[model samples]
Target: MAERSTPGSTPGRLLAPPSLPDGAELVMRVMPMPADVNANGDVFGGWIMAQVDVAGAVLPARIARGRIVTVAVNQFTFKQPVSIGDLLSFYARITRLGRTSITVHVEVHAERDPVNPQLVKVTEANLTYVAIDGLGQPRVLTRQV
Candidate 1:
């Protein structure tokens, strides 16, 4: 019998993942280093989640024209493991606007092969953020023209 190799068996290549919808925006890109990896050799999920939160809040913060704080993470799903050296990109869009809070949907994709730049979505989450005053209290979000 002869040995065979899968598409993703290569050290720095990502197997194809599902494609995203049209008009999706790219928010941020980050590459996790050794410091971000856990003892078990995988990147920390919380670290990724934190990045998502920051990515999700960016637009709302601009809309509110002030500071904000993450109030909740409605839903989070990790579809794949993140390893060191993978280039992570966060994509986000505003989903809802409330009196003082904004809900955002964020998707994270990792580039496994630097040269080829193939991306695989590894996680998705919905996060809510509340606009805050200088004193760190929730403030009303007024619509901007």
Candidate 2:
């Protein structure tokens, strides 16, 4: 890969961009608005976490084939600060499938600088969601015959 200045870094210095996780499926893409920015001028971490939860549920929702609720955020990491107007792409892959819960690994990448064009891994997380029934109780995942 051609070297370019890493996102949020000074120009003239070259750094190779990190590679996206293998086999992860693109789940969501969104750009933060000015309103999402925090006092430090970076996008609010809470907003990003909320987005992650939604993106992380994509695969589990499909597998659950019904109502599902986030039961846990097993892990979360912020690699870089997000800026307003940066296009963020969320990628997710199922790491575990249980009887009624599913765990997913989510990676968030920020694409910035229209002129230079850099994609940086900004945030990553592992979340678990449980299948729910009408009563909002955990429901067993039906086996495919």
Candidate 3:
């Protein structure tokens, strides 16, 4: 139960988190498999990190207009634990752009209790990615759109 805004989302119910920003895009959606859960019965944070990394890359890859690789995870904060059977949605938006690197902010929301339907903010992170050339070298951006 929370009353504060979720940094980049609009306020919702106590169990439900605020909605995502207009600029943010729903890049990925998935349900955690039983194998992805930890001994505590919640989804492992590591698995979520991997998914976040992939989701965080969506916008930078488009902005780079070519190949891009994750160079850094600037920040990561887990607002709530994720569990199996929870439908997760990953949303992302560009936060900053550099000559060869792009920074993005990503947020993950979980929809649980199918009958009652609870939406909660599970995690959020800021990641940086660099544009890469065919040779794997940093490539300068040609345009910003």
Per-model TM-score, in order, reads: 0.80, 0.86, 0.86
Better of 2 and 3 by lDDT: 2
Q: Runs in model 1 with CA error above 4 Å?
A: 1-18, 21-23, 115-117
Tens-place lDDT per residue, model 1, 1-145, is 1122345576533344347544356778889989888779999998998888888877788889888889999999999989998878787778888999998888888877644555688999999999999899999988642
- Candidate 3 wrongly placed segments (more than 4 Å): 1-17
Q: Which ten-residue region of model 1 has the weakest summed lDDT?
A: 1-10
Would you list the clashing residue pairs of candidate 2?
none
Residue-level lDDT tens digits of model 2 in 52-122: 99999999988889999999999999999999878888989999889999999999988788677778899
Model 3 RMSD, rounded to 1 decimal = 6.3
lDDT of 3 by residue, 1-145 (tens): 3233444455563444467876888889899999998889989999999999999998888888899999999999999999999888898999888989999999999988754566889999999999999999999999795
Worst 10 residues of 2 by lDDT: 1-10
Candidate 3 Cα deviation (angstroms), residue 124: 0.1
C-alpha RMSD by candidate, in order: 6.9, 5.6, 6.3
**Looking at candidate 3, what is the lDDT of residue 108?**
96
